[model samples]
Target: MLPKIQHLLKASPAVTALIGAGTDPITDPVRVYRHGDAPQGVVRPYVTWSVPAGDVENTFDGADADFFRVHVDCWSDGDVEVEQLAKAVRAALEVEAYCAGYYADERNLETKRYRIGFAFDFILSRE
Candidate 1:
């Protein structure tokens, strides 16, 4: 699921233009990462995501779907840049997911980087 989400983000031209089309989408150090795994010295306007919460959808018949609550964060050196990147990320993922909520923009006083976060809900069929 993480790989699929990363592919969706990297494949969007709007997103790549802001972050970068790293040499390899799968191992791109600067474009995207699983939450808290970003490399040191990563460039600005990158993205991180994680499935912080999830569950199996069980029915009378059987469990037939997976529900995931994914959190995507865009980090940049400035507010405008982070917002734009967040917009792109939202657009890229909305095809298969819906926005569940938004996290308030945050500014880290120590690193001076701005971050905008969004939560998305994804349901995948187990069949």
Candidate 2:
């Protein structure tokens, strides 16, 4: 797991509240996980992220900085629902670039329930 991913997980109080943790009961508070294996049974609405590949560099100050290719996957039962969840995630990440920005890539799923999926790619930095 990426260290930054864990950091975001741990530092999620504000986000949790904003995304409906204690206030809403049905949303399940937009569950989040890292490197979670898909179960043999059911998969609920959630967000999963992973570091596909990355590099660590030792700077002149003798400290290492890690640049990771992070992929965030958002899943829900509806398009608007998944999009709302994705928006919340993108807001929390708050990442930006001059040329590259957030884009939604839809995925098709074969399941017992109708599902919508969205993906986002980002270069995450950790020192």
Candidate 3:
């Protein structure tokens, strides 16, 4: 699932490159990167992910179940133009959402990160 999502995002024209592990020494302990066009005036935003939901299940008659879950988050550094940021996010997610062919899904904005803060969280499931 992680590879699939990474591939989809990496294939996007807007995405410039994928900064995998052990490239940066000054960054966090997670895999981070600068994605999107840089020379073409695209701000390479900071991207990170966490698997907050692990595979587990309730105990009923000593039964076991498995579930796949994760969260992929991307955020821009410093103050960037809201319009550009929105366009960048839409461009990235458009390809990630199975090429939805439209960028009009639901989004919720959180102000804890920026002056005009926002975070796009897409809950995905593949059966």
Question: All candidates' TM-scores?
Answer: 0.87, 0.61, 0.36
Candidate 2 has an lDDT of: 0.51
Scanning candidate 3 in windows of ten residues, the lowest lDDT window is 28-37
Model 1 C-alpha lDDT per residue in residues 39-116, reported as the tens digit of each score: 888878788888889988778776588888998888999889998999899999998898998985999899898988
> In candidate 2, what are the lDDT values of residues 44-87, reduced to their tens digit?
55666665556776778757565555666666666666666665
- Which lDDT tens digits does candidate 3 get at residues 10-126? 444444232223335455222233232122322334344344444555565656544433344444443443334445544665553422222222222652222222233333443
Give candidate 3's error at residue 71 in angstroms.
2.4
Off by over 4 Å in 1: 1-3, 24-30, 60-63
lDDT of each model, Cα atoms only?
0.83, 0.51, 0.39
lDDT of 1 at 76: 94
Q: Give the winner by TM-score.
A: 1
lDDT of 3: 0.39
